[model samples]
Target: MKTKHHILTYALLALSISASAQYGSQKKADNLFNKFAFADATKIYHHLIEKNFNADFATRQLADSYAYMRNPDSATVYYKKAVQQDNVPIDYYYNYAQALRGIKEYKQSRLWLKRFKEAGGLIKKDRYLKDNDFLNSIFNAKHHYFLAPVNFNSKYSDFGAFEKDGTIYFASSRNLGTLKKHVYGWNHEPFLDLYTTAKRTDSIVNHKSKIKGDINSVYHDGPLTISKDGKTMYFSRNDFNKNVLGKDNQGVTHLNIYKATLVDGKWTNVEALGFNSNSYSNGHPALNNDDSRLYFTSDKPGGFGGSDIYYVDIKADGTFGTPQNLGNIINTNKNEMFPFINSENALFFSSDGHAGLGMLDIFATVTDDNNNIKSIINLGVPVNSSKDDFSFFMNKDGLSGFFASNRAGGIGGDDIYAYNRIPQLKIEGSITDATTNAPVPNAVVTLLDSNDNKIADLLTDENGHFEINIDRNTNYKLITQKDNYIDNSRTVSTKGIESSVTSIKANFVLNPVAKKEVPISELYPIYFDFNKYNIRSESTAELDRIVDLMVNKYPYMVIKIESHTDSRGSFAYNDKLSKERAKATYNYLVANGVNASRITEFNGYGERKLANGCDGTKNCTEAQHQLNRRTQFIVVKME
Candidate 1:
C-alpha cells in the first residue's frame, strides 16, 4: 500500500549441435544480440542454456531475439520459461503479455498485463486502459451486495441518505410542504431541504416530513450530520445568512457548513462555521466517531485539489480550530465530496479523479496508526457504477448499508439504495491456446494460496471453461499446464471488493511449444576471376557468413562446396584451377571457425560445368564468362 503512488508508473532456439565444447560464451551471444543479429544470437543463447551457464539470462535474451525477428509464437515459448525464474525482472511480464496478445491469447494477455501493473511496471496509457487490475481486484471482495432503490425516491434529485434514532434523514429536491415551486438553478428542481421519515425495512418511506426549525432555510441546505446525543447538528447550506445571500466577487453563492442546536425539541440558533467564506465553498459536513474533529469538503484555497476534504478541531467553546486538509492521498485534482467516517474510523468519500469506474465513485481508505492513508480502495461494482455513486453510509453491522447512485434504472437524478452484503466465493474462466484461440480442454488448473500451498486442482470441460469456489479475501495463484505447452502462473488477490460480484475471472491461455519452418538465409553465389583459384576479397565476406551460420547460427548444418571455372582455360588447367578454388573456399570456412566435420563435400568442376554454353568455341562477353567461375554451397543435411 505504501507503493500505491508508484503503481501506475507505468525467443527461440532449436536444434542439437555437434561438439558442445565449441559453443560460444554469454559475451558472444550478447554481442550478436546487440548487433540485431538475432539468428546468430539465438544460437549462442541455446548453447549457453544447454551448459546451464546463466541460463535464465540466456533464455530471456533468446526470447527477445525471437520477438525482434517478429516471431511471437516462438518468443512466447522461451518467455514462458524465463518468467518462471524468480531472478528475472518485472518487464518480462509485459513482454510475455505482448507475446500472448500477438498470438491472440487475450485472456492470458490480460493476466500478464495485470501482473505487470501490480509489479510496478512502467505504465503506457494504452496498456493500462486495456487491463486495470485495480478495478478488477474489486470483484474479489468476499461479499457482493444486492442493491435496490429505496422506495421514497422522487423524480427530482434525492440523495444523502443517513439513519439515526430509528429515523431516516436525507436531503431531497422535492417541493417542501407544497410551498410555491422554488427550483434551484443547478438541477432545475425545488431547493434542497432536510426531510425525515421512520426507518422501515420494507414498503415505501411515504410518511416523510420536512425537518422544522430555523435550520430549513429558504436557500439550499440539508445533507446534514447529527450527533450521537441528538442535541446538535451540522449541515451544509448556501452562504444565505440573515435572509440575505452572500456571494463572492463572481456573484457565485458558495455553500457553508452551519451548526444548529435542538432547543426545547425545536431546532434553533443556526450559525455558520467559522471557516465559512464568501470567496470559496465549504459543505458536506461529517463527524468522526468521537466528534472531536469535524470532517467536511471545501473548495478553499489551501487544499490539494478541486474540493478537498478537511477536518477542523471542534473546540469546547463551540469555536472551530484551524482546518487541516486531508492531504493529497485521499484528495485529487477533482471534486471530493460527501466525506463520511463510519463508526469503524474508516473514511469513505466520493471522487471522480481517482481510479474508478466513472464519475464520482465512492472510495474507502485504509490508514496506518498515524491516520496516514495506505490505500484508497474503490468500492466497486454495485456500490459503484459508470455513473455518480456516492454518499455511502455503512450500518453498524458493516454488512447492511445505504448509498446513492444515478446509475441506470435509478428512480431519479440520484436514488438512495439499500443493500445487504452477501458472500461471493468463486473464480471463473476458460482455457485456450495463445496462438490458435482454440479451446484447451482437459488442461489442468491448479490453485494455490499466497504461501504456494496447493488448495485445489481442476480440469477444464469441453468448452475449456471452469469455475471453483474458494475462501474470500485471500491471495491466490493460478497455474495451468498441458503437454507440449508452456505453463502460465498468475497471481491474484481478493481485496477492495465491496459490491456484488460473485466471481473473478482467471482465464488461462496456454501457448504451444512453437515449431516453425527453417529460417532461410538469402544466398548470392560468390564470384571468381577467370583462371583464379585464390579466394576473392568479395567472396571472403560471403564465406565468412557461411562460417557464422555453421558455427553459431546453425550448429548442425552440413554443407558441400563446389567450385567452377570458365571455358577460357584448357580442360586440364581449368580442372586443376577449380580444385584449388574449392580447397581455398573450404580452408577459409574452417579457419574462421566452421567445424571441419560440417563440411560434407568439397570438389572442383572444370569447363564441363560452364554456366553459359560458351565452351571456348563461341565468342562470349567477359561478364558472361565470369559467371561460370563461381562456387556453390549445398545443404547436405540440416536439423
Candidate 2:
C-alpha cells in the first residue's frame, strides 16, 4: 500500500507538471503568434506536438502559425491533421475552413462553416458583411446554405451549375474521355458535359444527381448556362481530337461555345454560336436576360492577352455582329474567362488575369449607364482557392450556384463543386495620405491572386476613399501605389472568420522631391577630400538624399552619374580615378533599385575636363580645386 501510494503521488505530480507545462507552452505559442512571429510560434508548437501535449490545439496552433507565416500549404496539412484528431473545437473548424479557402477550397470551406454553425457555433451574421472574404456586397439572412466542394462525391468532378424546376444542371468531365488525347502535355482533362440533378427548394440544402442530356459529346463540354426564361442554353466544348490527329488546329484545341434551344422541355442539338465563335477560339457563354447580347470568352488577336471576355450584340435576324474588344478596362494581358450574368444585371466570371482569391476564382460587377462597369471583385474564401477555380454559374435568385476547383479533397483534377450562395456581402476600403488626408486619387491599387496578378486598379476619391463590394469566400492582395510614394500591399483571406468590415489605412508621405520643380540634379552631390578621388563621408549623406529622391520618383526620371578629376594627378591616373568614381556612384544607385534606364553612360572627363581652371599645380587653393573633383546628376528624361 505504501509503495502504491508513492507511485500514485509520483503519477499525480507528473500529471500536474505536464498540464502546467502544456498551458505555459500554449501561452507562449499564442504570444508568439500574436506578435506575428509565426516561425517562432511554429517551433514552439512543434515541440509541444512532439511531447503529445494538447495534441489537438498544438496542431491547430501550428497550423495557425504557418498561416501567419504566409505558408498556407503547410497550414492546410496541419489543419487537416488537427481536425482528424477529433474533439477539436469549432474554432479549429474555423481555422481549417480558412486554410481550405486559402488553398481555393470554397466548397469545402462552406461545409466547415456549416458544420461550425451546426455544432452550436454562434458567429455574427453581419461579420461577412464587412469581412474581406465576403464579396457579394449584398446579403439576405435566409440564404444560409453553403455548398462545400468536399460534399461532392468522388464519382463526379463537377462545377458551373444552372437550375430549372426540379433539376440542376452542371458541368463534369468524368468518365467520357473525348478530350483525353488533348492533354497537350498540360493538365487538360476530358471535355466537360452538362449533367442534371434532382433538387427541392424547402430544405436549407438540396442534394443533386446528374441528369441525361442528348447533346453530350466526347469532347470537353460543360459549364452550361440558361437564359432567365430557360429557353436558351449555353455550354463550352473543345475538339481536342483535332490535335490527336497531329493536325495544327489552334482554335479547336481551346474552348468553343455552343448554343441550344430548349424546346418542349428538352435540349436540342447545340449549334455553334457563329462568327462570334471564330478561328481564334471562343467559349464560356453567358446570355443577357434580354437575349440581345451574349458574353463569352475568346483569345482572339488584338485583345489584351491570352483570353478576354467578348460579347456580340444579337441582331434582329438572330445573327451576331462582329465581336468588339472590351478594351483594356475590363480585359487585361491575362486570361479572363468563365462569365455568368445574373438576373440582377450583375456579371460574374473567373480569371487568372484578373485580381482574385487564388489561381482562378469567381468575380462579379454591376454595369452603369455609361457602359462602364465597376471593378471585378473576387468572391471571398469559401468559394475560391489557390488552385484553378473557374466555371462559375448562379441562379436568378442568387441563392445557389456552382464553380470548379482542383483543390484538395476533390475527386480528381478540377472537380466541379456546388454551393449555395451565402447572403453575406462585400465591403471595401481605400487608403490615403493622412496629412493631406485626401484620396491618393488615381493610385494604382492591385489585388493579387494566388498566382500574383494585379487583379484590379482602384482609384481614390477626393476623400481618398476607395471601396469595393465583395461576396463571401475569396482572397486578395490589396496593393496601392502612387507617384512620389512607396507602394504598399496587404494580403486578406476570409474563410471561417466572422463577417466584419475591415478598414486598412495605407497612408503615404509624398517626398518634396516627388513634387514638381525638384529636378534630379537637386538630389545628387559628390564629395571629395579637398582634391582627392576617394569618396568622402559627407558624400554618403548627399547620396542618401538621392536615394530618397529615387524612391519618390520611381519608374520615372532618367539620370546619369558623371565624374571628373583634378589636374593634380597624372592624366592616366586622373582618368582611371574618375572612371572608378563614376562606376562607384552608378553601382550605389543601382544597388538601391534606381532604374538602370534612369541613369546611363558614365563619362570620365579626368583632368581633360576641368570644371574650373584647375591651376595645373598641386598647390592650388581648395576653392579652385573643389571644382575638378566631383560628380553630378544629369537628367536624361522626365515623366
Candidate 3:
C-alpha cells in the first residue's frame, strides 16, 4: 500500500495554509510536506509554530508529517490539539482516532471514532451495540493466548513471520552489520529485507542471514509466503523489477506481489504477477492449503475500503486466473488484509473494520468449501492489543503460531511474537432480587471448586455484578446470601464446554422472606375444653410460625395477644377465662424463644366482642358460637 504521502494535497493544502494568514509564508512548509519530504517539512512547521505563526494550521500540518513519518505518539499529541479547531476537516477526527490507538488509548479512540461518525465520516458498524455480552466475550477469549517475543528482535522494525521446514523466514529493517546505505523516509529506518533463521528445537531461531536467491534488493522487500510443497513462493516488494523502479502518475512507487520458484535449493524465476499495476498496490500474499489458490491484499478499484483480500487460481501451466474479491461478508468499509488460511481452511486476517479491543485486531473466519465465509470472530487479547496486530501465521498443528504487534512493551516499531493457545475460563455473573428483578447489592457469594474446597469468597457490588474465574472441565457450586433475603445456591459445570468457549456465566437471584400481615381477620379456633386454658398440639404448630418470625426472621417484631370467649359463660367468669387463654398463648411464644418485651399486651374481652348476636338466651349452634372463641396476635411495632 502507498504511504500517507499519497493522500496529502499540495496545491489545495498549501492554499489553505496561506489562507490561515496569521503568519509568514507557509508555502515552503506545505510544499515539502506534500513532496513527501516530511523530515524537512516537520522542521519548517516546528519553526513556524515557534514563531506563533498560524499555530493551529502549523500544528495540524506538523501532526500529519509525523503521522506520515510513522511516529504516532508524537503525531497524536499534535492531532489532539489540531482536531479541536472548529475549521478542521472531518478526516482529522478519523486520523486522530487512529493515532490514539497507537498509544493504546482505546476509550478515547472509540470516542473520536464516534465523533468522526457524527461528523459524516464512514465507520464500521459496531457489533458491540447490538450484543450486550459482546465485550465480555472478548475478555474471555483473551485468556486463550500466550504471546512471547522472539530472540531475534532488533531495535528496528522486525515483523512478518513465515515458517517452513523448521526454518523461520521473516522481514526486518535491521542493517545486518552494515551502515545504512539506504533509509526509507517513512520511518527513517533501513528498508525491509527478507531474513532467515534456522529453527533447532522448541525455541525460535535468531536472525542469521538473508535469503540466498538474488532476492535481496536495495529497495524494500519481503513478507513472503511459501507453498505447502515448498516448490514456489510469493512475496511483496516495491515496484522494482529488472533494475527499474516503476512510479505512477503521482510519482509514487507502489508495492507489487511477485512469484518465485524454488530450484536446486535456491529461489529462482522471480517475476511480478499479472495483476501488478503501477497505480495501486498488491502485496502480503498467502496461499491456500493445496496451493491451488493464491490470496493477496490489494487496493485495486471497485473494492470496499482502503484495501481488500483477493485470490486467484494457480493454473497447472503456471498461469494465473482472474482475481476474485472475498466479498462483503469478509470485507468491510474499512481495511481487511493479511489473509492466512490454515490447514483447517479457517481464514485468519487482521482488520480495523471489525469492532474489537482497539485499533487493528486479528480475526478468524469459518469458510465453506468454496471459500464462502460463514462467520467471523475476533481473536481477542494476547494476540491482539490496541496497536496494529497482523501478519498472523500458524503451524500445521494449529496450536503454535506467530504474528506481529506494535503494542506496548515491544522491542521496536513492530515486534514479532510467538504464541500458543491457552484456554481461558471465567464466569460473567450478576445477582438480583427474584421477585422484583432489581439488583441485589452486597450479597455474599461463596464458591466451591470441584474438589469441594472453598475457592473464592465474593461480595457483589451495588449493581449486583460479580466476576468469577473458573477452570475448564470442572464443576463449581455457588452459594449466595444477603440481609433481608433468603439464602440460595446453584451448581454450575464447565464440563463438556466447547474448546472455543472461554467463560461460563453464572447469574443468581434471591427471594425476600414473605411478609404476612398479623391481624384477626382470618382467625383459627382457640377452643379450650369448656373452661380450661391450655395450648392445643395442632394449634401450637401455627403459633410457632409467628414465634419463628419474631424470634428468628424479624427479630425486632412486637406484638400483643388478644383472646375472646362466646356469650355462653357469665361475663365475669368469661373475662377471667379469656385472660387465662391469652396468657397461655403468650407463654407458648415466650417459651419458644420470642423476647418477653415483644409481647406488648395480653388482654381479653369476655362476651363483649360477640359474633352473630349469639347471647346465652339466643340458642345458637356450636359452630356459630365457636366463632367468638378466637385469638388475635396484633402487630404493634415491627421493624
Candidate 4:
C-alpha cells in the first residue's frame, strides 16, 4: 500500500508539472495579448506547438491572436485543433464560439454556448453581442447578457453612430474646455459633438473621423438628423444660436433647432432655422423621409409639460411656421424627449410619463385625426430597462438603430446601444366605479391569455387610467376588481390587428356585499407604504375578508379588486404608477385561486384624493398615513 501511494504521488506530481508548464506558455501568451501584439503572440504560440509543448493552450491562444488580427479563417483552424485536444476552458469555449458565430456557424456556436454555460463560466453576454468581431446576428441573442449600468464618469454621453454619408455623428459632452459646457448643463454632457471618421473601413480602431469644422462649438450638438441629399444637415442643439448674440454678449440661453446647408458637399453655412426656433429648450430633432417637415422636442410652456413633441412644416418659402405641440393626449406633464418620426409617419419618443418597463423608455404613439394620442405603446426590453433609456434612431428598414442608456455594463459611461425593436401590442384603459362614476382608483386588472394563464396585471391611475404593452397573437381576458366592489371582465382578441396600442374604458361599480353591521372592517385588503399607493403584504388580510364576503354573500358574486394612489408628481407619472399598482394586487388574488372571471377591476388614484389626509403629510403618523394606501373590491356581478 505504501509503494502504491508513492507511485500515485509521483504520477500526480508529473501531471502537475505538465499543467504548470502549459499554463506558463498560456501566461506568456496572455502578456502579449494584453499589449495587443496579436501577431507576435501568435508566433510564440505556434512555436510552442512546434516544440510539442502544451499545444492545447497554445493552439487556443494562437486562435485568439489570429482573431484579434482579423485572420478569422486561421483562428478557426487553431480553435478547432485546441477543442479536439479536450481544451475546454470557458475562455476557450467562448472565444471559439464567437469565432464560429462570426463565420456563420450559428448552430455550432449555440452548442458551444451550452457547453460554456454548463462549465459555470461567467462570460459577458453584452460584450459578445455588441462586439463587431463576434457573431451578433441571431434574434434574441442579447438575452444572455447580464444587464449592468455604465459607470458614471464625467464624459457627456448620448446615442451616436456612423452615418451612411461617411460623416460620424454622435451625442457627446467631452467638455474639451468649451465655454460653459452646455446651455442647461443638464446631467448629460452639455455639448454633443459631431465627428467624422476618415473613410478607412479597414480597422475598427480607425473608425473615429474628424469633427467637421468645429460645427459643435458651444451648446448641445446632438441627435444629428442628416439629410439623405447630403446637401443639408439638421440637428438639435441647446438654445444657443450664434445669431442670438446678446447686446452685452451673454450666450444663447435656450436650446433651439438649427439647419446647416452643405455647400460643395461640405457643411459650411449654418443658420438658425426660422420661426421654429423658440426661446425654450428645443432639441432632439427627427426628420421626415422627404425632408419636408422637422420633428423635434421642446418645453416651451405651451407644451404638455417637461418636454413635448412639436412639428413644423418646411414651407415653400424656406421658412418654418409656428411649431405645433402634439396635443395633450400625446404630451403629458411628465418629460418627453427624443422624438423620431419614421417613414410610416408613426412617431417614436422617450417618456418617463408613459407606462413602461423602466424610468424612461421608448414609446410609439400615432397622431391621427385631431392629432390625438391614438395609440401609446412601449418598446420593451433589450431596448428598455429600469434606467434612463432614450435617444431613439432607427434605420430605414426599421430593424435596427441606436439608443442611449446608462443601463449596466458597457465600454464607457452611458455607452450608445444598438438594438432591434421587437414589435408588441399594448392595451390601455381607465377603470372607474359604476356607481360613483368616480375613477376606481387602485383597482387590479388582470389579463389572461388564450390558455387561461394570467399574462399581465395592470392597475388604474388616480383617474382610473391603465395602459399595457404586450405581444400580439393571443386572446386575453381583462378582469377588474376591488375590495367591497363587485368584479368585472371583458374578453379581448389581439389577433388580426396591427394595433400597437389600444385603449378601452372599463369601470366596476361595487354593491354593498357584507352587512354593514358585521364589522367596520377595512374597505380593501391591500395596504400601501407611507405616502405610497403601491400595494403591500400587510393589506392582504383585509382584502381577503372582502373576497370571502363576496364568495359567500351572493355565492356567485364576481368581485373586482382595484388599487389607487394619491396625486403627488406629474399626472403622467402618477397616472402610470397608480395603474400598475392596482393590477399588482389583482394578480396576487388570481394567483391565489380566485376565478379570473370573478375579478373585474384594478386601478390607481395617483394623487387623486380617496381620503384627503392620505396624500402624505406630517399631520398623520406613518402608520395612519398607510391607512390611506389601500385596495378596494367592487361587486361586478351577482349572477
lDDT of 2 at 614: 60
Model 4 agreement with the true structure over 1-639: per-residue lDDT tens digits: 012111111100002224334434545665554333455567678776775555555676688766655555687788878676532456677667777877888778878766776787654454444544222232223331222232222244535443554444565555454345443333343445665543323223211433564356554565567766776777655455664532212433555566887665467677767754344556767777688888877766666666677788887877877788877656788767777766555677787777666577777663323433445646566777777677766666454456677676654445566554433346677766555677766677777766655544445656666655544656778877566665567788766774323343334554434443433343444667644544456667765666566555545666555555554457667666766777877776676656777765566666674555655444555556545556666554556
Each prediction's whole-model lDDT (CA): 0.73, 0.60, 0.73, 0.58
lDDT of 4 at 376: 61
Q: Per-residue CA lDDT of candidate 1, range 279-387, in tens?
A: 8877778888888889887778877767778889998887889999988888888767778887766788888888888777888775543555555667788788888
Regions more than 4 Å wrong, model 4: 1-156, 160-162, 165-168, 175-190, 197-208, 243-252, 276-278, 367-373, 421-639
Per-residue CA lDDT of model 2 for 287-372, tens digit only, reads 77687888877777788876788888889887889887766656777667777676555667666666665566567653333435
lDDT for residue 32 in candidate 2, whole number 0-100: 51
Off by over 4 Å in 2: 1-156, 176-190, 200-214, 239-252, 276-278, 421-639
Go through the candidates in order and give the C-alpha RMSD of each one to the true structure. Answer: 22.1, 25.8, 23.4, 28.3
Name the TM-score of candidate 4.
0.40
Question: Model 1, stretches more than 4 Å misplaced?
Answer: 1-143, 176-179, 200-208, 423-639
Which rank order by lDDT, best down to worst? Answer: 3, 1, 2, 4
TM-score, every prediction: 0.48, 0.41, 0.48, 0.40
Q: Rate residue 528 of model 3 by lDDT.
A: 55
Tens digits of per-residue lDDT, candidate 3, 1-639, equal: 122132111000001223223222355676454333466667778877776655667898889777755568998999999897755778798778767877888888889879888887755557214433456546643276776557877777777788898888888778667744588877677878888886523333323477868676877787889988888889888889999999899898888889888888888888999988999888888888788888888778899976778889999997899999989877887777788878755678877778877766788774332445645667887787888788898887565779987788887877788986644456768889988999986677777765544554556766887664566878888878676665677789888997667667788878674476544343344565556678777788778887777777778777668788888767788998888999999898888888898886687887788766888767888788877887777665555
Task: For model 4, give the 10-residue run with minimal summed lDDT.
Answer: 5-14
Q: Which ten residues in a row have the lowest lDDT in candidate 1?
A: 6-15
